[model samples]
Target chain A: MKRIVLLVAAVFAATMPAASAAGPVDITFLHAMPGPLGQALKQIVDGFNATQQEVRVRAEFAGNYDQLLQKTMAQLAAGQRPDLAQLEVSLVPRLAAGGHLLPLNPLLNMGNWQDFWPVFRRQATLASIGGTVWSIPFNNSDPVLYYNRSMFDEARIATPPATWDALLEAARGLTQPGRVTGLGLILSDIWILEGTIWSAGGEVLSDDGQHLLLDSPEALRAVDYWARAVREGTARVYPDIQSWQADFAAGRVAMGFGSIVSWRFLQPQIRFPLSVARMPYISRPAVPVGGANLAIFKDIAADQRQATWQFVEWLTEPAQQARWAGLTGYLPVRRSATTNPQYAPLLNLPATPSLKVGIDQLPFARPRPTAPGYVQVQVEMRNMLEQILLQGADPRGVVRQTVERANRILAEEATR
Target chain B: MRKARPVQDTLVLLVTAVFAAPLVWMVLTAVKSQADVYMGPLWPRSVHLENFRLAWETAPFGRYFLNSLVVASVTTASVLLTSILAAYAFARLRFAGRDWLFLLALGTLMVPGEVLLVPNFVTVKRLGWLDTYAALVVPFAASAFGIFVLRQTFRKLPVELEEAMFVDGASPWTVLWRLYVPVTLTSAAAAAIFVFLGAWNALVWPLVVTGSTAMRTVQVGLASLIYDQGYNLPVLMAAATLVALPVLLVYFAFQRLVVEAALQSGLKS
Candidate 1:
């Protein structure tokens, strides 16, 4: 037994050097992407591996977004952080501000970073720490309205609502006993609130990105509008966004706002025709840019950094981005890919008529603030909103208190 | 009494049905088409048997099942042995500051697992056990809950039997091994089941510690099966069914033993 163990150990030892020597650049790439997009990402890595011999990129799906953050933080403490991390936009500031990320500009300086879209660039280039461009946008998407076309046609609610008044009217018009709801309000989801509030010309954080602005007129109008829908029976408030999607597919909802990526997953399963449109705007046409950016960890070795950069650059290329967008509903970061012949067919899917709405809203997209305390800020805001919607509290007063508490949290961070 | 028993049984049945509703819904949906899963009636019109096959083929479940089974088994075994020894030492052995020591062990239960995550991860990394089964099993081998439960059980075991063992020239270790273990098997079984279930279903820690996909357990594998673009829900359900099957089988097989042991332990204590 000992000799066999020794023989196995000797073989493993002999192979280790060769395995280490083969890649010269094997970097651990961690991501929070689940489902088909996760598979698509692995395929992208495989493509890169096949196309080049210089780098060996290993892709890992790190569960969900929040759990990924915790995992990354733990790994950072353990000094085994990944070479590249697909961090959500909300978490970028916290990770970058902690000085755990390497600026993408250095990597971009070596290549043509301008090949990417301007909106995507802005979302990623917020100068995370000491004016450093910490990460680059990869899987950028905006929330869009997905409606069952058959239900809309039956109700004569054409063109899917473009303005807030139209949205409320259509929602009310679509409601019937033992029938579908006009809208599904995922009151428990912070992302829905962020997108809706921002569209109403409200900023989640102050202009200086230093304070919470929930009490601002824009936020107040947004909250009031949302509350009216819930109270007036135009929308059915769900406890969670996950449950809402399931309900929507069952014809429980007439219209719902969700990530464009949701369409790829949801469209395949729905029996009826689906229509997509820009998420209804109130004061202005705006949407919060969601999804994640690819970030390099500070602990990555210098040589491995180059390999990771090579993979990142290759993966974000127009062809690859277009292919990724086609496979996944996430909008391509590269502009040229939208008009690509291959993606045109995907965009023309009968169910996803307005799939491009997310990409179209990109020019008017507002990214979440890059403040260090933004994650906790959003969670607290979601909690406050849930209290108002589910528990039937006064929205205006609860929002006021939430704004105050958020500002205090922001203020504490400012001094720190 | 006979007249009331049927009513009681009916009430129990209703409660069980209410509790089992979600699991039943999940299984039914797994065997139904997309439209039938959502829009159709409660009972599926037809069962799509391929969903289970697809779900099984989607990932390396064979390997994941083995990994889960081995890790859970080892963890349960180690925890049962360690908790018994530690509990015996605390409950029966005369020691200095034993109460304080017990309090210290109990104190760890108050600290949320989230806070220790980073420290434990760093310790495991330093020990170079990442992606290995040891990473999943070792840190959790000494469970405070197990110790507490077993200690309570050990405290209630009769002192007369221990004294009789001492008179028969049995050492404290022998007494613990022969008498305490046999007497507290029920409590130990309960503890083992709890630990086994927890280890079998752990998500975040295992996902973080195990770097390689090959080393991933069923829970992580299932999550991985649901890709970001979309999930094959039928397959997801099928895989869920398969994963749940073993647990159900184990529970039903040992349920009588489990109940009898729990009753005996509670009554004796």
Candidate 2:
């Protein structure tokens, strides 16, 4: 028995050094970005795995933004949390506040933070809770107006609309019964609705993050103006985001307002000539940035934390970032990466040149407010918006009630 | 009873056909080419059997099949053992707050499975059982439904069996093994099959805890394929067909046993 035990111990000791030499730290990373973006992530993981003998990073697709939050919460509760997760830019505050994520500031400084773009630097810095950088920006994209160019030509429109009035006129020109609608607006997606609101110089919440500003005149006017497109005979509003995308792709809609990352899926299937332009502005030009950022989960072992950091840092490198951006249609986060010679030719490609439209808007892009209980609050807000747009709920009264409810949610979250 | 039989039969057929339509479409789509899929009608223009082959080859479906089979079988066996022992005690054995304890066990049925997800995950993680089959199948073995159903099955059994076993110098375990289990096998089979399906198709917990592809079950594998590949309808349908095949086969093979067990368990009390 002693000899057998010694033999087993000897075998284990012999294997231990080889495993450590191979950098045997394994990391689990969850990301909301899927399809081409997920493929890009896989390539990054493959590259990381090939380059090192020690740390092995594995990528898992954790559904879309809302699902990722649900899955992550469950995992955290189960004590089976991932090493790193791709959180939406706006959800960072709650995760950080809950002490579920590790702040990236110390790690960033240790890893030479000079190469990142100023916009990302500012945006990432702002998203952190209590001046702690809990997440690093990845796959940041802004909304753009994608148009079926053949439909535009058929409607006798020369160029895409650059202003709200022109957009309205274009919609009027494009609308045809049983064939097509002018603008495909999804009433259920609050982010799209807020894009219109922000473009119209409206605020949904007070800048302090403590008050509800939905009752403000500017906010009311923004809603009323948005309702005009549906209220008027020019266009149709979709009950959900999927229908909007489907209608646009099926040639039932002349224009679609979606994320720049949509080009990854849209470009591959579109049979008609497609073009992109900046989303039309009302009072001011504004586009809410929507995409995910990579954050390290707290409570992991130190080596696993290092492995996670290594993967994240490598992912943000100019060459890999540019490649990922090209593949996924996500705007490259690093300024140098966007300008890198490697990306220029791909950006110049005709079928997907539209990707540059969103890249150009990064300087003006800002994130939605991140707060605890935002998911429940957003669901209520979405229901309210959908009710007004689709169900013909009283816009003024519903808006008032929603603001009150949202404020209550904020107050409840504040106490926690 | 047969006065208006034709209309009722037609109506029943129509409803059944409508419900079966999606499954039929799934089968046809699985064997259809991309062109046929894009054309998008109720049926394929021509069969493209290569889709199933391609989807099967794309990942480790063979390993996934084996893993799922082993996990489901182990889970069913464990649940049967635990539930039978617990159920016999609850049904026949006298203890302090026995009724209260049984009620508490049954009361857990009211709580949604999602609420227990986090605490169960934490328990598994603390035990360092992540990515292991034991973690996936073990905790879930002690099920409330199993205990409740088996208890019902045990109570319905003639008390003479237990008395006879005791008179012959047999203990509870001996009685349980020799007589009780044989009599209650049908109810136990019903519970085992239900738990088997739950464990086989489980997504949330496995996706949360396991990191490696080798550790993934068929459901997670199919989900990841869809997410990774851009809406390739043919390939997705093929993958779905593959995932459904085992469950379908199991049902067909034991259709008689399953039905008999289910009816006996339900009608007993």
Give the whole-model CA lDDT for all candidates, comma-separated.
Answer: 0.80, 0.76
Off by more than 4 A, model 1: A1-23, A107-112, A340-354, B1-7, B226-231
lDDT of 2 by residue, A1-416 (tens): 99999999999999988867864788888876544456667887898899977778877876567667877997777655789888887788788888898877874574436566655676576432576677888877777888989989988999899888899899989989777788887655667667667777787666546556777776777777667877775667776655665566667888868777666556544567778899887788777776678889988988898888888878777777777777767777777776767766544434456568877776666676556656667888777878777777778999989988888988787678
State each model's TM-score restricted to chain B: 0.93, 0.88
What are the interface RMSDs of all the models?
2.5, 4.1
TM-score of candidate 1's A chain against the true A chain:
0.88
Writing each residue's lDDT as its tens digit, candidate 1 over A91-162 gives: 887777777988777745645567567777677777535666778787877788888888888888768789
What docking grade does candidate 1 earn? medium
* Candidate 2 chain A minimal-lDDT segment of 10 residues: A345-354
lDDT of 2 at A139: 76
Stretches of candidate 2 off by over 4 Å are A1-28, A32-36, A49-56, A60-83, A106-119, A237-239, A267-271, A297-310, A345-351, B1-4, B32-39, B57-59, B157-186, B226-230, B261-269
Model 2 interface RMSD over true interface Cα atoms = 4.1
Give the DockQ-based CAPRI class for model 2. Answer: incorrect
lDDT (0-100) at residue B23 of candidate 2?
Answer: 78
